[model samples]
Target: MVPWSLWEKLTTAPWLSINAAGQFVQWFNHLLMLIPFGAVIAVALGISLIRRRWWSAVAAVVIPMVAYSLNIWELFIEQLGWWLLIWLISFALCRTATHYLMLSTTCLKIANRCQFFWPLYVGLCSIVIFHPSWLVGVASALIALIPTFICQRLRLFAQLPSKPLEQAQMLGANKAQRMQWVAKRWLTPRLQNWRARTLQQSLLYCAFAGMIGLPGLGQHFYQGLSQGQHAMVGQTILTLLLLQLLLWSIDHAHKEVL
Candidate 1:
């Protein structure tokens, strides 16, 4: 069994300082990591909103807001406003992209087939890129996510009954018109379930990217393990478990709402 003094030293040593301000600053820096972490869910929520999944959107927004309310609220109120703006921008961008993709069969086909070798692509990029930067992390995460996104979209597209497209075509609807009509009538509704699942999967991928230098809990956890900092490792594990619980609650709430 560990002595109380030793446990205290283990837990507090990382933040121990003679100056109070310095200790506070260290804590603040650690909490700042939540911004990007929360942004993942925010971006996912934005995409879900674009796909017209209102319930999942609500869950996504509320879960993070509640989960990090204590630590993140005091970190930067103004930055929260910036995040909201970012969410709005993402919403507009996704909506426009979806509109354009629906209008162009060539673009849709390209998107479907472009990332066929995503696993190889991710591995090659990770191997070649030795330096760790936010750009590298973002690029890696996006590379891994794009294929999953396309597959989810295609799966939804397949489940769509052919009757609506056929009916639209029968009425002399052009290719674009049929595509748009089917998208609105069928694809959007079915997208809610998959969007929620995708958001969960995206969180996992984002966390995994931390091992490759993505900032946040995962990165800190990896560093702690490498440095043999038991306290830091334990803290990160606890934080990650809390995060997982929050996500599960959000997912459960989303299911009930549906």
Candidate 2:
């Protein structure tokens, strides 16, 4: 049976206090990993406008704003430099690698063959390397996502109609031109979907990294459990649940628009 003190602690523990400041910092860092969410929405809005997809544009803007609110600005302001640095680094790496894979059949084949082994690479880096926890966590999430992103894009390419590409080739379009045309027509419309999936998976991996000593809600929860801090454990669980609910609502709204 649980002690009365445990129940009392749970009831009386303050949600915000000097002692909980570290948890708030960890939460901020965790939310920082979501920079991709904002990037995706911004790009989606642009693409929708260019393509004259009015409903898509409205849904893109309104749904995310309603679901996530303007609190993101607070996160950005709190860690403006760090947030921009991480977003730039991650965006550049992902775009370069993805474009390279899309344009090079040889590289695509290699990535496909070795994609399933990415976990080993992540394990090696996390266990053997001596990087900062935030770096390790972000790197691990990116590494873990490589195969998934590759496979999804490959499937997208395969399912796309080849007639347009063939016609472009027959009209003396260069390889780069053909790739650009395909991206503009087929890929741009779907950037939000892809980025949403990436963000969801990234959050999961980042949280999991907490088990390995990364400073986030997952680490906080782990520590709470280890030290038998029931109040902290409950708070962490509640926070995670709320995060999951937010993701679910976004996905649901996205699907409804589709």
Candidate 3:
């Protein structure tokens, strides 16, 4: 016999009934959860400045700022599937070297020269510290980093250059030839690798977010499981699966110019 948890999730599709109180509660949860994102930005900036690396500061601080300013933040909070898509696009478009640099400087263990532990550094510096909840910021950065390092080490993915076509021109290729080469070789292979890494990282982020009680799909899945909200559980599972399929199909279709 199937376990009750498994049976409920698979068999009991929950109806989207109108729950005004639930709606309000959801909104409030979003607000509370997102307040930390600002701290995430601030700390990233603070770290960059302390390290005297303005480029890192700009990437760590600026991109998320732009995403939030453009209301992409809200989309992620309200719709997990869309949020995953947003992350996918960002990952696909970034320069390979730049993304690796950011990950190394901010998240990975590449630089830890401080004799003091990070907590003590925070204390001695008298800079606003992690408020006990600050681990969320560290964890979020790490969540993005682990796969990035793995990808770099294995060359599992390559980033799209800001101007891949220009390189062909520098080699004296005409416009037509340059375009053909890019489509046939660089663009497609890079896209394929990017898609594979994106899917894997997205899954990692989803799982980590749930473990840490972060907002969006992870939080939703966690709550549903805890409350025995069978319908919500089914919804989250299907949403993640559909996202994976979409990613795979998009990569497949763009195989020529990925």
Candidate 4:
């Protein structure tokens, strides 16, 4: 009779082959789905940058959305962390921009800003007080955006005048202006920082989750290693590396914009 270990391996070989084939098919389907959407987004961004025409903007947006009927991009992004990365990058960049504003305020206030500190602190602290949920997160994001958009609209965040402008003339001194400034300076920066840090944190979380048998790329990678799918594992690793590079490029572009 064949050795027990050899027999088990032989028995499972076909199953292993099937699973690998499935994974390859999934990856290819994902690429096919995204390539068109990616192309359209790229084109729209170009036209928007160039012609600045609303119609082009709408066309750029409306045409590629035809992909949504296929829903492949959604599936790929759901598994791939692309959406998460975008959220995090946006949050990080905003937070970084706010840091300078906060620092400036700290010096300028010289005890004056302390009056508003408690409310601001309380508001921000509340976000971290509970376990995160999608509903709560979305509400919080909208609340944050209200002030952010206001600040951008009013140009409340342009650099302070070189010479000390009169406090009375400060654009952001009014209640509305202050709210806008605070939201722009604090909210986006805070969110962006949270996003970037959380994403990096998730690599660890996903690994730990795998150790506990949670399902994800981590679990799949683990299974691949156990079953000796060296090529499959290698491809997964390569895919992860490519994703990181893509995220890095996006961050670099956003940074340049900031």
> How does each model score on lDDT?
0.52, 0.51, 0.46, 0.43
Best by lDDT: 1
Output the better candidate (1/2) by lDDT. Answer: 1
* Superposed Cα RMSD, model 1: 13.0
Weakest lDDT window of 10 consecutive positions for candidate 1: 72-81
After superposition of all CA atoms, the RMSD between model 2 and the true structure is 14.4
Clashing pairs for predicted structure model 3, backbone only:
14-231
Mark the regions of model 4 whose C-alpha exceeds 4 Å error after superposition. Answer: 1-215
Give the root-mean-square deviation of each candidate in angstroms: 13.0, 14.4, 19.4, 17.0
* Model 4 score (lDDT): 0.43
Rank list by TM-score: 1, 2, 4, 3
Write one digit per residue (lDDT tens) for candidate 1, span 1-258.
999999989767754556765889877876665666566566557656666666666766665565465343332232333333444454454446556766787876664454344333543454445333444455555666664667567665645545477777778878876776666566555455553333334333433333333234445555677799987666554544444444444444443233
Q: How many clashes show up in model 3?
A: 1
Q: Which ranges of candidate 3 are over 4 A from the true structure?
A: 1-81, 88-150, 156-214, 255-258
Per-model TM-score versus the true fold: 0.40, 0.38, 0.30, 0.31
Clashing pairs in 2: none
* Model 3: residue 212 alpha-carbon error in angstroms: 11
